[model samples]
Target chain A: MKEIVVISGKGGTGKTSLVASFAALAEKKVLADCDVDAADLHLVLNPKINYREDFSGGKKAKIITEECIECGECEEVCRFDSMYYPDPENEIPCVNPIFCEGCGVCVRVCPVEAISFDDAVNGEWYVSSTSHGPMVHARLGMAEGNSGKLVTIVRNKAREIAEKENLDYIIVDGSPGIGCPVIASIAGADLVIVVTEPTLSGQHDLLRAAELTAHFRIPTVICINKWDLNPDIAEQIETAAKERGIKDVGRIRYDTAITKAQIMKTSVVEYTGGAVSEDIKQVWRNTIYALG
Target chain B: MKIAIASGKGGTGKTTIATNLTATLASMGKTVQLLDCDVEEPNCHIFLNPHIESSTAVTTPLPDVDEEKCTGCGICAEVCEYGAIAVVKEKVLIFPELCHGCGACEMFCPEDAITEIGREVGIVEEGRADGFRFIHGRLKIGELMSPSVIHAVKIAGRESEVVIIDSPPGTSCPVIEAVKDTDFVVLVTEPTPFGLNDLQLAVGMVRALGMPFAVAINRSDVGDNDVKEYCQREKIDVILEIPDDRKIAEAYSRGEMIISAMPAYQKLLETCWGRIIDIHRNWGELTS
Candidate 1:
């Protein structure tokens, strides 16, 4: 099966909106929203979850206070500054879970062995049925890290389901930023579509996203959403893409109906066969052609 | 008060509000600093146009194993949490991208062969624009150490009286690292289903960290009233509201700050800062 992942280095560039439209247009496909920190594809897909699984990523260190040595060895060795003394006068170092990277430096340094390393639940994932087809998505717990690991799990599960159902495509909605999560989403994908707007930030992040795809040796194309918002910048982006050997698959004009369709919980293609829908269809067609 | 303007969703006017508000504060004769902690794709430089006074590489440590002293007993590999190390036939392999540089491997190595070395992951820049200080980070492409760069940006400008941080969009580690120590946070979001969903996640994040926060809705005229209703039910103070304005969009596309592009927004943003200060003062004694 052919795999395509949609990402935008800058957020609010219509990545989820385009992925939803692709789900409606594609014949047989499984959707996976790898943007766990902000998974918004489900808002429009309306998935009926059939399978749920809790995802545990890495381990965290907890200070065993009762076994207290009060030696302050753990605090001295930690690089993340996760350990802090609640009371400066006379108190044991408490673990700030947010700053803790689960590096286990404190656990190993504790001379009295007063620390325990254990797995922590980071989030949950699901296999669900939607109007498009079976989909895979996840919800990250609040104040949790290791989002890259969870994204990998979602991708693997989506691929497995596609293999079982003999699906033709797997369209993944990836997160913004060129970080661990974005890398995990594009690692083994067959194609990457970067959706950007005509703003200055959009132009800047588009290059960064393209550089990431190039680093991974993944074939990538560009889709300019809300192109009419800044036609001059859009034209400049086209020239820049040409110089970088990237193709402009589509340039969707700004449409108020796009958000209106989102409020209705439907894709643009399903809501109306208007100009914006045609633009997205063109993106899909050009993308499939490029994949060949 | 030190405040971070953040959103769970991107393109929600976090940078716009941050730049304009800081400019307005500068006009009001406040000592302010703006730090763009969104290392991967920092856009504040595009609008603010600061003259970078200095550029320095932000480095992360990587374990360099001495082949002769290395017995490859596998203790280092066993202790690694990120799977960045592997021992094969008395040889070691290191995946630089996967390493978190927590000094776990070197600390646990029994053979005394492992040593830490520095690698450039990104760069931190310090500058100024219009009488206010500016700092930001730019993470190298294909690198995963954005949090480290973010930490550097925060540290570089921690002493300002009115510090405003423009954080990357998300509810995960990078976002947490940016907004955690700040006294106040402004969660910028739109009024749509996606916007509301992501905003809820961002809210839960700041709340988990025990940080006081408010909401700012962009494009408030277009979407449903679910976001407004959610904030009201939760008693979240709606600090700023900017309706769908094409002129603002046009100015932003040209990399122009709102306060500069349209002088009319000067009073609006100044008033917005007034609310932030008022709300923060009500939270009792301030830290730092």
Candidate 2:
């Protein structure tokens, strides 16, 4: 199966919007939202979850106060500043969960062995059925990290579903920025589509994203959204992409109907028939042709 | 006062609001500082068009094994939580990318076999833009860690009377690093399903951090009123509403701040600042 991941180096560049439209256009595919920290593809697709699983991405250190000594050794070794003596008069230290990076230095350095490292339930994942096909998505807990591991789990599950169902494609909505989560989503994908706009930040972020894809040796395509906002910058972005050996797949004009369709809980392609819809259709056609 | 502009979803106008606010505050003769902490895609500099006065490389510590003094006891690898170090057959392998620069392995090494060496991850640029201090961090392409660079950028804004931090999208470590220790957080969002979903996640994040925050709805006329109603129900103060205008988008595409491109926005930003001060004052009273 061919796996295509859509990403934007900057947020709010319409990666999920484009992925939702692609799900409507693709014939046989499994949808995955690797933007696990703030998963929004399900809001448009409205998936009916078929399976659910709890995810423990990493461990957090907790203090066992009963065995604690007032030596302050754990506090001295803690690099994250999570270990603190809340009650100095009592001389008992505590670990602030928010500041703890879960590095376990305090647990190892405690003279009395009072610190314990426990697996943390970072988030949840789901295998669901949407109108387009099967979908794999996840949600990371508030103030939680380890999104890279969750993205990997979601992608693996999507691949499994695609293989079991004989799917032809897996369209993934990747997270923003060139971070660990983006790396996990881009690695091993058959094609990468970078959805960008015609703003200065858009151009700069797209270059950073393209560098990431180039490092992975992944073939990439660029699609400019809201291309009419600044035709000059749009042309500039295209020229920059061409210099990097990346081709432009299509461009979509700014449309208020795109947001309206989102409010109606459907992809723009499925919710409206307009010039923007036509542009998305052409994008899908070009994507399919490029895949071949 | 320090205010951080953040959105859980990307491209929702954090930089737009931040740049305009800083420009407006500077025009009012306030000592303003704008820090672009979104190191992965630092865009405040683009709109501000600052003449960078100085640039410095931000480095993180990476462990360099001392083979001469090493016993290969594997203690350094054992103490590392990120799996950045591994002992294989008397040889220590270090993965610099995975290292968090916590120095735990170096501290716990039984044979004093580990020492930290600097690894450059990004650059922090400081300069002046329209009489306000402009500082931003640009993470090296393909670099995974952004919090360290963001932390460095935040330090540069500490001396200003008013600091505005433009944070990266997503409710993760990078966002936390940008918003932490700020007086107030202005969560900028559009009014769509994706926007609302991500906004709710951002709200949860801010609440978890126990910080006072307000919401600003950009492109207010485009989508449904679900965002407004949610804010009302949640008692989240709607500090500002920036109407969708083609001229604004065009000016943004040209890398111009709204306060200058559309002079009418100056009054609007001033009113937004008023609301922020009022909210912050009331928050102080409630806490006190």
Q: Number of the top candidate by DockQ? A: 1
Instruction: Please provide, for model 2 over A1-292, each residue's C-alpha lDDT reduced to its tens digit, 9 standing for 90 to 100.
Output: 9999999898888898899999999988999999998899999999999999999878898888889878888888776677777885788888877678888888877878898899989899999999899999999999888788899999999999999999999999999999878998999899999999999889989999999999989989999999998999999999999999999999999988888888889999988899999999999999988888
Highest lDDT among the candidates is held by which one? Answer: 1
User: How well does each candidate superpose onto the true structure, as a TM-score?
Assistant: 0.98, 0.97
DockQ of each: 0.86, 0.78
List, residue by residue over A75-182, the lDDT tens digit for candidate 1.
888899898888777768889888888989898888889899898888999999998999999998897898999999999999999999999999999999999899
Error of 2 at B263 (Å): 1.3
What lDDT does the true structure give each of the candidates?
A: 0.92, 0.90
Instruction: Give candidate 2's iRMS in Å, 1 decimal.
Output: 1.2
Q: What is the interface RMSD of each candidate, in Å?
A: 0.8, 1.2
Chain A TM-score by candidate, in order: 0.97, 0.98
